[model samples]
Target: MKNSSRRRVRPASIASLRRVHSHGGTNNQKQRSLSTGRIGFFALLFVALYWVKLGFGGSLSTSSKAANSLGSSAPRRNRAHLSYDAEEQVAKHKLLPEEAQIIRTARSLSPVTYDKVAMSFFVMYGRFLLPFYERRPDMKVLNIGLGCEEDISARLLRKLLPKANLWEAEERVTCVGSEIEGLHSLTGDQGDVQVLDSWIEKSGGMFDVIIDDGKRHHNCQVLTSFEKLWPQLTPGGLYFFEDLHLGKSDDHRSYSTPACDGSSFVFSDHIKNWLDDIIYQGGYNSKKWELHYVFCQAGGCAVAKEPPGTIYNKPPSPNQFDKKQMLPGEYHFVTTAETFDPVTDKVTTHSFFTMYGRFLLPYYQRKPRMKMLEIGLGCDMNYGPGASVSLWKNLFPSAELWEAEYDGECVEKAVKEGKLDGLNPLVGDQGNNATLDSWIEKSGGQFDVVIDDGGHHNCQIKASFDKLWPQLLPGGLYFIEDISGKSKPEHLIDCVWPILCTHDLHHSGQVEGL
Candidate 1:
């Protein structure tokens, strides 16, 4: 008892592990928080949009007089406009003594709030854009109508190239129509340019880079007027069009389902036509400024005027997935295996849904025998012959299939035609309780998989997922084909977070986890 041996010390409690170094891993209670944060993101998205809709009206009014020249007369070979004092404002932050001291102290402590709302997009923008800023001394930047539409693009550019002068346009009037405001607005029609010439004249010189995000309605005008903008750009500048998901400024909630009845994608058709006609219009010499590099995503696109300088010796890296993998099924459905028209099918579906299939293929391949449901029979006639329903049926033969569409007659025809082995379509609102109850009762009260390729409206997405996802068999997957700019309901996790933060452990509303 008197002998002193080294004692094993249990230094901390289980609660201490939970408290220290919080915010990562299983020990953190953040799973509950993240689950609620799901609801919070939707709250934030709707709040962000609602707040933007109600208050974010932008008009570009400047105190300076309108200049007829766009700094394109000739390249400046001198330091005539450079000032050390102005450069010190940003390049060398001459913060006041008190502010500098505060900043030094702030570096050692954890931030009270991480209100980094803009960091996500800024990270994405900078990924492909930093190279442009690096070569700025030899560049002239023109941001067409970026005045108020996307102030961040200009702000980012300014930060990236502090010394460079950038010319941006203020919307004075609608580009094509008799609309009072020059700002982009939601309208039934994609407005034509009525006063585009005025803005072009007022802008003065040509630009090396043009961002055509001025007004949503004027996308057509900007594409057609590339002849005007391209001349302004340096021999190898770029043209960017942001917020391409929205067809117009006014509409925030609809997307093109690219089934190609007759009309083409509004922006796609317009831009392609312009690209084809650019040679006839002139100034875009094919050999000199190759219209070579075009980059597009869910959000927008960037078209480069083949680089005159800074050539990369190495080829780009290989991609992880091929875009055309899902196209075969999509093509077969759209073409009815009849026309052999892969080109039209590719244009109609694009690669948007392929991303969903890419992620879901694993879950699907593993569970080929699970019961499945496909909502929204495309407008293929209203009786409900949706391409997704057809594709899923082919993908999973043994699995039972169910289809829902608003049009009962279309569903009846498909059922009569023995589509998916005579499985009669479940025709009703995908969001309705009665319809869901009837379907659940009819299909033994559960589905192993649910794919929401439905109306794609915000309300419909929320309603269908909220009401039905819990009915999914545990360990099953729910695949939703989401539009890039639009929010998906169950993205936070497979489960939609209960609005009430705390609930009874066994409440009837509670569902099994994914």
Candidate 2:
């Protein structure tokens, strides 16, 4: 059967089988292809595993570092040395112990170290009024409302005019002994205008310096004091009334009753009467006494002088009495724009929503040629026309400026324009580390005035004061606007009192604590 099968297999079929298995090529090619596929698969698996491990490990390490970093507290700026330097500068002024004591007391009352409004008034008055008294040794100074003797005004007066006698009036009679020395107190019915008149009459003739720091009985005080004190004032003397807002109160009838005496009237109506009389008749009819209204935030002061040619005789000229002169290179102007934009070549003026600008101008103008540094440059044009470099060129014509700003673009634009010549427009945040120091260093540490208008935050205001106070010139002025919003008299007593007291400067008995 095997022989028969072999015989049946054709020669052609045997030849094809031999040819198919010629060199074992098909089996080798198949084996090689399978091996290549296995190698590729293993390589891909290894790469995938390695990638997963690396990604997971990296994520864990990153998270751990982030947690550690976040857990740490930020370091505080080292201001100890700066504070010491400030203390030393104050010491150089060698302020008296009594003055220093008042300042300390004021500072202890609040967290802030300075009172911008009171301080501004004190400095300005000291600059202008003190000199007048200094030139005349026998000027009788009367402080009307002696709420508390621990103030800058009282201290400054004592220092500036050591020979001039000071008389202070209080609502209640208390011990005459205080830091101010010879403190005489008086008591009267509430809003009694006669009490002031009685005191003035008893003290003989008028005074050289009459300050109305009395109670806020606007109508009574105005009527009683205007008739009595104006005639008593020495020619060219000044009369300042505190708390003018009392005049605008609606309760005019409440100020005086039959039992309380007829000391009250419509205070606002009286002021309006005076204003109207001035407009229509070219002057008010206070028996020939010329009335000039001096408005301030704390209050308004009225100055009444007999006719220029009256028997009392006015000073050479109202301007002559004012020794204010424009500083070289100092100029000022009032523009409708709040800020100048170089790119658009436009001036954007801030709307007058309040009387801050109006009051600020007179205060600044009183100084004449003081060097000034304003933080809120365009918000309020308190410095007047020649206040900036552009306008100052025409006004002062020779003042220098060093302006630091947080907006780089604004600073760059201001510099590119000719509006700010000789002004160093420093670009950086006022709160940034070393930024204030850099500006101070660049400015050569000379400034007569410093206005904090940049950041109104309490911390920023305090920090700015801490940094800038040392740079201020002795007897120079520093203005911090918008303080009426959050600032109380106590805050200024705390921060500024210490520094001021250290220099033997004190408040004018205006504020209570200091």
What are the Cα lDDT values of the candidates? 0.39, 0.39
Tens digits of per-residue lDDT for model 1, 1-514: 0012212133232224324423211110001122232222222211111111111011100100000111112212122212112223223322122222222232222321011111111212332343344434435565554434334434444544455556555454343232222222222121233344444465555566666655433334444445445666664566776544444332421322223221223453344333322212121223433553344432345666644431222221112122222222222222322122111111232222222322233234445566777777665522224444444444455677777777787666656555435343676776566776777776674676676666644345555665665566543445544322132233222333343222112112111100
Q: Deviation in angstroms for 286 in model 1?
A: 24
Q: 371-399, model 2: which lDDT tens digit per residue?
A: 66656433123432112334223323234
lDDT score at residue 113, model 2, on the 0-100 scale: 25
Span of ten consecutive residues with least summed lDDT in model 1: 59-68
User: Candidate 1: where are CA atoms >4 Å away?
Assistant: 1-347, 380-384, 420-424, 482-514
lDDT of 2 at 57: 23
Candidate 2 yields a Cα-based lDDT of 0.39
How far off is residue 149 in model 2, in Å?
A: 8.2
Question: Using alpha carbons, what is the TM-score of model 2?
Answer: 0.38
- Give TM per candidate: 0.32, 0.38
TM-score of 1: 0.32
